[model samples]
Target: MEYICSVCTGAYILGATGLLDGKKATTHHLALKVLQEKYPEIQVISDNKVVHDGNIITSGGVSSGINMSLYLVEQILGKTAADRTAKTIEFVH
Candidate 1:
């Protein structure tokens, strides 16, 4: 269920939706600690490249959105598809 893409502080919205409760999630590094303190129900993760917990996929920064997208493609469409997508898009990572 990694189809969801919640990036940076945008996870705040998802958190408000109650979708992040009890789920390991992440957001901008600057907001990581506060988001956790603000929502103890959410197992906020930080200092990672990306985070995938159940249906939610969160990126820690703007650039991490690409990594998160690649991760989602791999989860939903297979690694080969993800690789192809990345190659086709000239993704360096």
Candidate 2:
């Protein structure tokens, strides 16, 4: 299963489930300290928009989520398809 962190706080859920153990992750700046303090087993990254460790992908915040969505479309489909979808939605990469 692919686990994506919507915000820093969500990392706790993933970490609690053991999916984020020994993996690099990040969260919203506001939650970084608390997340790291709570999940010491997980490596917390700072000043990052996104962090992908294995099948788990974590985004910093809402905008990062949108970027991740577009990136996933490109990865699962292709650049052409992603571009087409982006154009349709009027979202530039």
Candidate 3:
């Protein structure tokens, strides 16, 4: 199954479940340090708004959730479908 964490805090759930162990992930910039400290097994990235490792998709925050959504749509459907969805939602990306 695919997992999409809309915000940094949501990653905690995945981390707690050991799904993020040894994988590259990301969260809100403000929580980057804490996330890293909390889950030393996870490679918490701070420079990305979104991180996709295997079936897991993690975003930094609410705004980045848009990008993550589009990415998921693109992955599941196609770029055209994702672009159409973004356009319908009036999202730039």
Decoy 3 TM-score against native: 0.92
The estimated TM-scores of all candidates read: 0.88, 0.81, 0.92
Q: Which has the better lDDT: candidate 2, or candidate 3?
A: 3
Q: Which candidate wins on lDDT?
A: 3
Candidate 3: clashing residue pairs, number: 0
- Residues 6-78 of candidate 1 have per-residue lDDT tens digits of 8889989988889899999999999998899888899888777589887778899898899999888888889
| Candidate 3 Cα deviation (angstroms), residue 70 | 0.4
Could you tell me which residue pairs clash in candidate 3?
A: none
Question: Which segments of candidate 2 are over 4 A away from where they belong?
Answer: 1-8
| lDDT winner between candidates 1 and 3 | 3
Q: Counting only residues 3 or more apart in sequence or on different chains, how many pairs clash (N, Cα, C under 3 Å) in candidate 1?
A: 0
Give model 2's TM-score versus the native structure. 0.81
Residue-by-residue lDDT tens digits, candidate 3, 1-93 = 666565767888888899899998998888889889999999998888889988788999779988998988898899999999999999998
The regions of model 3 sitting more than 4 angstroms off are 4-6
Better structure of 2 and 3 per TM-score: 3
